[model samples]
Target: MAPQIVGLAFGHFALRMNPILLLGALTGAQTVTAAMAAIQERSGSPVAVLGYTPAYPIANILLTTWGTIVVAVIAS
Candidate 1:
């Protein structure tokens, strides 16, 4: 996944910058969510999951929207 994300970054460098940042953030969110789930499973507590659960979706949406705005601005 990391490698693929890196490939995407390089692939899009000529196109624009916002997409690379957006993809990187989305990948990071997935990685953290997975790690938190693993920790929660081992710890047998919801605390680990709670730490990131609420912020994940919100960040995803906000970052995606921000990326779109950036692209639009850059294009114009």
Candidate 2:
């Protein structure tokens, strides 16, 4: 719902309002913010942490994929 509202905002008045383009715009912004968070985390630098929770779900899925097999094998 929120992303759609944002997408529409980007679509209707901001540039040429295409749903696909708007979605891409949102996705790109999220990605950059996420990478910025990771860099800050790695360098032990302070980051606007609360502002970046959107990327946590994406990071969790990635970690689960990479570690599930290893974790299962170890548990056995």
Candidate 3:
């Protein structure tokens, strides 16, 4: 999931930099992704690079919400 999100993020980067405002948004989101992955690992449910199933959906939602809010604030 991290890889997928990172891939899509790069694709977004390739497409355009619409409404470019403050810097640090990309790095911030990456940090959020790392936090999510770390939480999953702490729970003993890691989603590795090769293949695995994610076990903590709720925690992921929280991390994602955190990321979204950060992005939104930056975008605004």
Candidate 4:
């Protein structure tokens, strides 16, 4: 929650990104599909998905790779 709040603020104020799209991207990075869905539904626009799509796959790949590294480290 804290990270999400900070990210939203940073994206909105510092980066000057659209709040709705930033929220979508944040949700995507976190792999929170439900939040993304709610955002789209509330905004009545699929535009947020533009932010989500790229972030989602990248985040998934990075997280999976990191998890594998962590497991290898633990096993070693």
Q: Which model, 2 or 3, shows the larger lDDT? A: 2
Model 1 per-residue lDDT tens digits across residues 1-76: 7765675566477655444244434444554566565655666665544435554787688779999999999999
TM agreement with the true structure for every prediction: 0.48, 0.27, 0.27, 0.90
Q: Report the number of the highest-TM-score candidate.
A: 4
Off by over 4 Å in 2: 1-7, 32-76
Better of 1 and 2 by lDDT: 1
On TM-score, who's better, 3 or 4? 4
Residues 1-76 of candidate 2: C-alpha lDDT, one tens digit per residue: 5864776586668767444334434444455555555545664644334323554467567667869988888999
lDDT of 1: 0.59
Pairs in steric clash, model 3: none
Clash totals, every prediction = 0, 1, 0, 0
Q: Where does the lowest 10-residue lDDT sum fall in candidate 3?
A: 18-27
Off by over 4 Å in 3: 1-55
Candidate 3's TM-score reads 0.27
